[model samples]
Target: MIAADSVTVYRGLEIGAAKPSAAERARVPHHLLDVADPAHAFTAGDFTRLARPLVEGLQAEGKVPILCGGSGFYLRALLRGMASGEENQVEAAAIKASLEARGAAEGFAGMYAELVRQDQGSVSTVHPNDHYRIVRALQAMALHGRPWSELNKEARATPPAFPGLRFFSLEVEKEELKEYSRWLSGDQVQLTIHLDKEAFISLSELRAIRSRTPGTKTFGGLIASLIELGMEEWSLSNRTATSLPKPQRDKNFSL
Candidate 1:
């Protein structure tokens, strides 16, 4: 399993971040934990770059790699790859400084208005008070001659790193599940299961069953429940206790 978390990514933050205990780690091998120093800034891009290879390696070995954590942006970056451009850091910094100066002189409201003019779609995504992103978006528009939102849309159109991905969100409230469903609408997931609190299964038990079953098809009632929950593609099982077909090495697993 790989963690897509920011708080737990840093070293020496166990208690503060409420990381899994050592006993839990002993039960399942976890990756990307305690990888960065507290002083180092670990961005979503950095997490995606590091995790992609690890997930691929596990898949190559015919092992399912579960991704866990609460860092939505990092998870999105890992799943949908980032926009590619050769950044001119010096020019970007200059532009950022100029925008900051403009904000200081003309007021933040004016700078925000400029951002809205550049890409109205970004208004909902970015907080109105977020000066850093406001400057960065304007800088991107200045450098690329396109809005940051447009760049993001183009990046999302790129082929996904992992196809045939299934997402299972366990023990989520109905409201949160609805929100997650909306957020993941464009992901093209093969299946998305949202289990209620009553149906919650212990992670250790679930892992044990998966390890023992290998590719054993059909979780009888589980499949039924999924179907009832509006998954029409799932059909009744035909295969016996046989190994599941090994997924392509390039695919990723998430939970």
Candidate 2:
């Protein structure tokens, strides 16, 4: 599933961000996930530059591009538009190590205090445990003697470029959406399962439909749960995939 929609408009950040599990991805190919450290600012520009081509390429190959996440800005950037300013792809590991060293020498709390002193605005938005942001804020301060927070304020004001792209926003019914979210987070899916139209309809009515059919059963129960909640049509393709990895052929097509 394309995480574009899921990443666009969901609350409860962490679990929402972790919407697509490893097993789920093993079944169908996914473009981007966990690309950003939750503490870092993952801008729309980043998504446009990195993810847009993947989505388009998959489409060109006649494969299904399931955009399944809750980052609305990212989805908009890919389809409708993008926010301005290049993504600050800092060396998070290096920055964290530097901060850790600073904290060890002077004090971790003191280092954080220094970050606040340099840029209170960014600090307010960033989590305290995010050493990477703290270090980057400090670096930004050292570079210009002004806080990174102030820079972000200026950056956020700039508008993105993407007015012509089409947007088919999936509007999930409230109660159903809640149940679906729960089902997605749960480990109900134990085996990978791909289905045809006949199989899909039959499985929808029977929770243990796979008992009557032969397919990957890992996440069949989860799919059933999602169907019961009423699936929203964000992006589904009738295109038969021609260029996916060999292992993924069965997932994108009815074999």
Candidate 3:
């Protein structure tokens, strides 16, 4: 709602989406949330396309663009720049609108069926609620005899334009961050934990302190220990605390 230097995709989504509440909506203007019906799916690339301009325009006006969302991948793509080829606003809008109307009339399932028949590639991963995208897939199939998914895949395969961009993850500590599981959706928590150490924490503990305390580091000591040991066993102190904690303890020692 309040489009500034960066765009804030609304928070507090319900029904499996984190959307901003009504009170929250009045507090600030938001751009994307409940933009798609629950049945519809929105892709990172699509979001990147819509948000990039919002971000750039905000900067152009000397406003700071903030891309805020639970969808870290979406935020990353927008900031890093998703490859959408060159923008053809007229064509893009028309294409998007036409697809929405057509999908509405044809019914989402029918459209998805047609998409699968024509472009299995897109159907495999595209969600049903994502009517806009399903329609787009069908449109691409009619035009190119291939799924629009191919372009998306190609885009992902290509590296981000602004490779130098630094993505900072707000980290939380293990024992401290253990409370997030309750408030966070399973997928959100899973995403936060994936490839990170906190994933090992019991869901109950994670639920207890998630909001109160964040993990000290994104990952856990286990992987770090493995990395340091490098396939050779070392005199690991108190395996859990011995590896890294000992050094910190030593640093803190001395009268």
Best by lDDT: 1
- Taking all chains together, each candidate's TM-score versus the true structure is 0.55, 0.38, 0.41
lDDT of 3: 0.50
Using TM-score as the measure, which candidate wins? 1
Candidate 3 residues lying further than 4 Å off, grouped into runs, are 1-66, 71-84, 139-146, 164-255
Between candidates 1 and 3, the one scoring higher on TM-score is 1
Q: Model 2, range 21-95, lDDT digits (tens) per residue?
A: 558769987665545533234445566777778777777898766666555546655654422233334553354
Model 1, 1-255: lDDT tens digits are 899876677665454355889999999999999887654346566788799999999999999999898776677778886543446767766786688678768877888888898789878766677665676678778888887788767777776678778887768799997887575454313222332331233322232122112121123245446557654333324233235676576556655
Task: List runs of model 1 lying over 4 Å from the truth.
Answer: 84-111, 129-139, 171-255
Alpha-carbon runs more than 4 Å astray in model 2: 1-29, 33-49, 55-96, 103-107, 143-145, 164-255
Overall lDDT per candidate, in order of appearance: 0.66, 0.51, 0.50
Total backbone collisions for each predicted model: 1, 19, 35
Q: Give the total clashing residue pairs for model 1.
A: 1
